[model samples]
Target: MEVASVLHMNGGTGEASYAKNSLLQQKVMSITKPIRDEAIRRIYNGKLPKCLAFADLGCSSGPNTLFMTCELIETVEMLCRELNHESPEYIIFLNDLPGNDFNNIFKFVECFKQNLNTRVVGGIGKCYITGLPASFYERILPTSSLHFVHSSCSVHWMSQVPKGIENNKGNICMASSSPLDVRNSYYHQFQRDFSLFLKCRARELVEGGSMVLTLTGRSTSGPLSNESHYIWELLAEALNDMVLEGIIKEDQIDSFNIPVYYPSSSELQLEIEKEGSFTLNRLEVFEVSWNAACGEEHNDNSEGYKVAQLIRAAAEPLLVNHFGEAIIDDVFHRYQHILADRMSKEKTVLLNLVVSLTKTT
Candidate 1:
């Protein structure tokens, strides 16, 4: 499958859209706010440009997109006030795949800018927001153009499905049941893709500019040991249940794989060192309960249902591409019951990793 063409969150502000289901991602940004703030502050102190340019790579549509942009703007404005320096003009790039919901994002631009002008203390400077539809795996910005680069819950996505995983049947992701070769194939693909990511961003960032990235990750060395695997494990179970009931064919499940990997901190460090363009300044690992971000607002929904909706908003496009749309709802409904049972027995938490980097070249 062409990941770039099919990989996008459910668009629009409807009930199932990413805009409504992205509280988890927003919570992650909040968790890593200190690192992101420090990086931006470092750049401002080192050299505050007349027009501060930055890009929110893999910035999917929603309140979370606005949240990141607002934080950046507010951070700069606060700094300017304390330092007694003139506020710099802002050039913010909202970047994502070509298939992303750029229309929805644009709808918020005018209103967001209007609010910024009236809300920020002492008022803010001129701010320009643009939609950049492209892949971060490739160079999408001019060399030495960005002062600060930020990406959240995005870089774990592989550019494409790894080759030679055809044998990884009965699983939709790298599971414990996957063969050794299948596991190696996934890791090798992550290594190549992440290394290229660093190289691409390295070229786009100015020397000494900062980058902060946060993604779903694992605390342990084993690839399948993370809670992220349980998401797919339950998904696989749901598919298997359908296969038994003749809702879908067994071969269909065997033929599909999710193009994502959750790397351990050691693995991430190794890739940064091998890429040789950016210096890794700080790395941190944190955990969040599966239901922590959604809160009591979703109390009417079962714990399993809440998590299912979150995954559906993110994974529906990909699932629809592989399986027909007919079985999408059934799949998640089954997944919800399975997850609910599991979570009831034990508290489940997702591991997250945040890293800060500096362009050295």
Candidate 2:
């Protein structure tokens, strides 16, 4: 499957759009607030620059997209106030796939720049914000132009499905039952994608610049850990239920594999070391309950429904491409029911890894 063509979140401000459903990711980025601030401080460190370059990679359209950019600019503004220097002109790039909804995100840029302008004690500087439609897996900007980089809830996505594991036969993602070779295929793909990502960013960032990345990841139990992959496991079950009802073919499920792979901290560390571009400064894993970000209580299975919407916003386009648009509602309804039953019995949490790294000399 061509992931970039169909991997975008549900667009616009609809109830199911990623704008509303991504509060979980917003909350995750909030937890890393200090990392962002510290990285900005490290960049200035008494010597304020005349121009600052910032890039928000994988910046999809939503409240979260502009919300993220504003935070970065605000961080710089606060630091400039402390240093008694004029706020530097910003070269901000909000980047995503070519198919992303750049239109929605651009609407907020004017307001973001105006807000940043008001706080500057002197006249406003040029905070140039523009969208660059390209994949971060390869070079996206000119060399050594960026001073600070930030990516949240991206980079776990592999550029494409792993080779030699087309069908994954009966599974859509890495699971406890997956064969050793299938697991290795995913790990190797992540290693290669991550190394290249670092390499590209290294070339773009000025030496001593810092990058902060927050992405979905696994805790212990290794790369094949079921705890980290329970969502997909439940999804596979939901697809099978649809098959039993003859709503969709079993072969469809057999041939479908999510183009995402959540890596363990060890795997992430290994790739960063091998890439030899950036030194890992701070790496941390946090456990977040599935229901933590969703506000409403779920005595009536509403929690399951919300979980389905959240995941659906991100995964539906791909599902539509493979299973046809006809089955989306039915498939997610089944998934909602399955998840509600499971949630009523116990709690499930997904691990998120937040890392701060500095470009090597």
Candidate 3:
């Protein structure tokens, strides 16, 4: 399972070009709009159930999942009109990895029900989008029936691909180049996929539910250098320059890798306090500058070099399937001219964390 075969051959070209680039949808909805406005003010101050139920967990599929599900239903209808309550019954869901792109997220939920039948926010009413594929560490929800669980850039991804890197030789990831045996084998598979995603979202959350997790991490803790392991050494030097131009074959680069995992923030608060049903309310940390012109100087281009050329055009078909398509467009045009000459010499950085838990029951 080469990470579920590169998510079933790049899950519909990574969720249909995840909203055809609007500067990577404002760097993933500007860090997921303050964790969806603090999980709609802690589910309207813990009153909870209004039949709300939201879930994006690895959503991925066009128009940045309807622009982060219309900014999480306009921040849960402005926290149910500042807690007066009532405007609920809005289940969204939209997970991923069952070879996602659920028909382009159900055609972007029928263009979000024809743009909410002609948009009318403050007037409320309209946001029922649904499209669950599954694989959020695989429980496929439904126990207590969630109340909110957003996920950006998906849970530091890893449902596979860390298994004993073939008896470790070519470094089976722990941030390779062997840093303490690949960070104790990437923190033992990020503590077994974050304790089976907090025991399957704590049996599908309900008791004071709430979870917001943005990803792409690493703010020191050993290994991860060479300019923060520049995207796995620029995808293992574009698959060893496509196996030295023979076009894929060195045992398919020792049978590919990259299920990815990048925790921090005290190793994700020690796996959400050893899966005791969450609590951490926030763990912030931001720096994302994929280099282009570290924000500003827009007209002169470099929205992080056009979101690093839409993540190198959605990782160009897994970099031309282990580098081949004639040296995959000259190795992504020399990796976008060395990431735009290292953003004109200020180097680059990306880190990012953004937590916010809750659950506790």
Model 2 whole-model lDDT (C-alpha atoms): 0.83
Kindly list the per-residue Cα lDDT of model 3 for residues 72-162, writing each as its tens digit.
6666666777667766667788887766557856755765766754563554554576777667887887797887787876677788767
TM-score of 1: 0.98
lDDT of each: 0.89, 0.83, 0.65
Instruction: Please give the ranking of all candidate structures by TM-score, highest first, separated by commas.
Output: 1, 2, 3
lDDT of 3 at 76: 65
- Model 3, runs deviating above 4 Å: 1-42, 45-61, 71-75, 78-149, 159-187, 192-209, 212-247, 260-273, 277-317, 327-361
* Most TM-score-accurate candidate: 1
**Candidate 2: stretches off by over 4 Å:** 116-124, 221-227, 296-300
Q: What is the lDDT of residue 205 in candidate 3?
A: 81
Clashing pairs in 1: none
TM-score of each candidate? Answer: 0.98, 0.95, 0.34
Predictions: Cα RMSD each: 1.2, 1.8, 16.7
Tens-digit lDDT track for model 2 on 179-268?
Answer: 888888988888889989999999999989999999889976465553488888898899998888998898889899997889888888
lDDT value, residue 316 of candidate 3: 50
* Residue-level lDDT for 174 in candidate 3: 50
lDDT of 1 by residue, 227-286 (tens): 667777788999999999999998999999999999999999999998888889999999
Window of ten residues with lowest summed lDDT in model 1: 292-301
Better of 1 and 2 by lDDT: 1
